[model samples]
Target: MAAVAPARRRKRRSVPIGRMLLLGFFLVFVLWPLYWMFNTSIKPSDDYLTVPPVWFPTEPTLVHYKAALFAYRGLDGLINSLIISLSATVLSALLGTLMAYSLARYNTGGQHLSFWVLSQRFLPPIGIVLPVFLIYRGVGLYDTHIGLIIAYTVFT
Candidate 1:
C-alpha cells in the first residue's frame, strides 16, 4: 500500500451548557423580580395576605392606583418628585460636563481628584444613610422637596 487519505469532520455548532445556564441565570435574576412586582401591583388587596403566595394574580384591579392618584393626592407628589429629580439631573449633568472638561484640559486638582471622586462609588450607601438623615433633619432639610433635590444632586 502507498498511502491513505483521512476523512474530515464538521463542527457541531451548538451552544455550550455553561453558556445556556449563565443566560438562564441572568434572565431569572433580572426579570423575575420585575415580573413579580408588576403582577403584585395589579392584584387585589386580599392577594397580599393570601396563603401560598399567588404567583400569577387571579383578579387584577387598578383601584389602588386610582385611589393613590386621586384620593391620596399621589399626583401632586409625583409632579413634585419629577420637578425635583429633573432639576437635580440637569444640574448634575451640566456641572459634571464642565468639571470633566476642565479636568481634561487644565488637569484641575491634579491627578488625585479623579481618583477621589471615583472612590466615592466604592463607599457603601447604607453606611452614610443615617448620617445624611441626621444632618438633613438638623438642617431642616428633612421631609422637604428641596431636600430631595439636594440629596439627589449630591449622589449624582
Candidate 2:
C-alpha cells in the first residue's frame, strides 16, 4: 500500500489595516462611556465637576455605593423591580402558553388572528401610552406594583 501524503494547511487571511483601525475606533467609542461610568462611580463627588475631568480618581471610595444601597432606598427599589419583573414574566408565560395551545389545537380565530396578535408586538408602545394611562387611571391601577406588572405583561 502507498503511504498517504500529508494534507496541505490553508493559509489564514489577515485583516486589513484600515478595517482594524476602524474596529479599534468603534471599540474605544463604545467602551469609553462604560469606563467613564465606572470611574465616576468610584470617584468622590468633589471630583465629578472638575473642569479638566478626573480620568482616574486618586482616592477612590465606595461612599456612593453605600449611600445608594442604604440611605437612598436603592435596595427597596431593586426588590420592587425584581418583584414586578418576575410577576409579569410568569403571568405573560402562562397566558401566552394557553393562547398558543388554543391556537394550535382548536385553530380558534383561524390563521389571521394569530398573525394579528403577533403584529401587536411590532406596534410601538408610545402610540398606546396615552390610552393605557387613561385606562389605568380610570381603573385606579395607577402608581401600584400590580399596575406595573399588568403593563409589563401586556407590553411584553
Error of 1 at 85 (Å): 1.4
Question: lDDT of each prediction vs. the true structure?
Answer: 0.89, 0.95
User: What's the alpha carbon RMSD for model 2?
Assistant: 2.8
Q: List the residue pairs that clash in candidate 1.
A: none
- Badly placed stretches (over 4 Å) of model 2 are 2-6, 109-112, 115-135
How well is each residue in 1-156 modelled by candidate 2, as lDDT tens digits? Answer: 999999999999999999999999999999999999999999999999998988899999999999999999999999999999999999999999999899888968867999999999898999999999999999999999999999999998
Q: Summarize candidate 1's per-residue lDDT along 96-155 as a digit string, tens digits.
A: 898888878896787899899889989888889999999999999999988888888878
Instruction: Give me the candidate number with maximum lDDT.
Output: 2
Q: What lDDT does candidate 2 reach at residue 149?
A: 99
Q: Lowest-lDDT window of 10 residues in candidate 2?
A: 102-111
Q: What lDDT score goes with residue 74 in model 2?
A: 99
Question: What TM-score number comes out for model 2?
Answer: 0.78
